[model samples]
Target: MIMNPIPTQSSEIRVTPIPRMTQGGRWRVEAMRSYTSDLLLWFTRGQGRITVSGRTRGFGAHNAVFIPAGTMHGFEITSQVFGTAAFFPRSLNLAFPQEPLHLRIRDAAPQGDLTLILENLQRELDGDRPKKERAAENYAGLFSVWLDRAKLQYPQNERKSEKADQLVARYSTMIEEQFRSGRTVSEYAQALGITPTHLSRICNKSCGRSASALLADRILYEARRLLRETKLPVQQVAAQLGFTSAAYFSRAFQNHTGKTPSDFRRGA
Candidate 1:
């Protein structure tokens, strides 16, 4: 008599882009690590348990959940699995809900609206990427409408913080995110309706640094990351850090750390 061995299923995942709603990528369960960058996940089909932000839930078909940026989490992948994930910038929450905490729908599934959003998202795969604002507006518009159907209470939200603090934190996260995109302090300040000085003051009081400092830090952090992690050469690294010339970036790096980028990378 011959006996059959049961095969153990590998619970991994991949992310497919659905147009402007997401920039494309794939993720496996093991790839879910403590990422400083934010991520969004949707399970189109499968059954498993996921622990996000420390809460575990059984998930499967017609069930969806979201994990905010900076959440330390992992999940169990079992049986036949399929899904899509979007790598959302932290700035996106400023335009809508706060992610894992906010618990906005990932896909409606059995719910009619969410299913439509997923369908529309799937259709996104075939076309050219739309302007981010248009795509964002579409997602925000449809999702907010669904949120309107939510019976959550505002009393808890009001008790969390005043609108000012909320806006400041959200915008700070946004600035840290998009500083490389060429927008300036004046632009961000004007958009936030405060003088640049006041915005700086708010940032200093809340985060112990000026808004400008935060932006520079993001740039420098990326510089250090590229310097140590990738094979891009010195001049290219300088350009990637938003410097026009390697000489200028060297000076800036020295000013910050008293060391040249080459020395830093060697030691790092």
Candidate 2:
């Protein structure tokens, strides 16, 4: 079931339950959408698979997935799944994971604590108490702390290659800032003081996608978001995304999404 939207004066934090199923009891074909908010998902029951940045992984009960803002992700729950998802606005300023994390809470104590933290966060979101926003932020901070500890106790295998991870993280950050400038992968490589081939290799090892593909993915994600969430004309959207002309943007969009801009906007 879809959880009710949180009513709040500020959009810094939101807590909601994952629906047992999406529309028609099936996952949307375009489920790989990126969000502007960081997402923390705690699965209390059931099993499923999630894809982040083109790398797919399986998840089960007591697993917590942390997806940083602007990362492309999608999930398919094969059975009855129960979970709470907390979305933190980009401006929230918490020291959570900057990279994607798929953590399994194997111990009982941490699992219970996580459940309680989610409960408190939900209560703060659902209540009208004094300083509700502050209380909610506090809960979010606690959640971040818990995540840090959990990572220390259960380090991800990706951390084994620290240098490669750092390079990928830096590349991702640069893409976020310069994706609107129409920079090419070679240009990004130059900025990062690395060759285009080296950059692609690191990105492939980290996320199973090439550097050019990642750049294109970020650009396409922004284009789709603008098309779906705004009333901007196609030409204007193209210009805002640094395309030289509307026709060029249309071609690129069609190549990436298999739909023309007009059709995508209308369907959305």
Candidate 3:
């Protein structure tokens, strides 16, 4: 029997609280992964660490992070940390930053302005007003303006590029592009003119994870997303993700997520 699907909100833009993103201990959010849509994270309270583009930084209250689509990132959120995560679809072609930006807003005036913009954007997306999607897009543009202005105000201090950081950044960019091609960490190291051990060591120093773990985190994140969002069969999903076979994919996925592909697809 065919079951009617549950209703979902508009995909063009979505504003959700930080805690909701991790309601079920969603490891995908905390793992090294990228999204198809640009993400704007506004942290109004508490503090934690967030890694963007292979570099980890501490974040506190009144922080805004803009991650462009296809950039690898992850963050730690504690019970005290509360904020809004806004998702803007890449297809919208809005004026979001081209690179990942982490801005610490110190002044109360700008902080309040950001809060008001987010509230207004959230309202437009949630309401049933005429042309609400268009309205939300406009507000998103304003959000982009706020980002540009804030960037000007809080210019990032230029840090010298250490060898470890450069190597890890290159490795991360490669992983983002070719993770689905079934490339191993060793192969990546070879292409980068380094040994696997050196690569893993650098990755650990840069991102607090080994090279293999980072690669697996990205691949499995895509696997879970495909299983959850698409109607593709297990075998097809495995093939698409460059796994040798469905059984192997099932084992790897279960090892990572503790659930088989089919079971995870059924929301089990």
Predicted structure with the largest lDDT when compared to the true one: 3
lDDT of candidate 1 over 1-268, digit per residue (tens): 1111110111211124222221111112422233443444556676766554323456665444555554544565544655655443443343434545333343343356655665564455344776644564365456445544442521123245545555556555565456556566777888888888987777665445576765665566556656655678889988765677899889988887678989877764
Which segments of candidate 2 are over 4 A away from where they belong? Answer: 1-11, 18-38, 45-58, 67-82, 89-101, 129-131, 157-159
Error of 3 at 197 (Å): 1.6
| TM-scores for every predicted model | 0.44, 0.75, 0.88
Stronger candidate by lDDT (1 vs 3): 3
Tell me the whole-model lDDT of each prediction, alpha carbons only. 0.53, 0.78, 0.84
Judged by whole-model lDDT over C-alpha atoms, candidate 3 comes out at 0.84
Off by over 4 Å in 3: 1-11, 23-25, 262-267
| TM-score attained by model 1 | 0.44
On the 0 to 100 scale, the lDDT of residue 148 in model 1 is 43
Cα lDDT of model 2 overall?
Answer: 0.78
lDDT of 2 by residue, 120-141 (tens): 9999889999999899988999
Query: Roughly what TM-score does model 3 have, to 2 decimal places?
Result: 0.88
**Pairs that collide, model 2:** none
Candidate 3's residue-wise lDDT over 224-261, tens digit each? 76776678899999998889999999999999888898
Clashes of each: 2, 0, 0
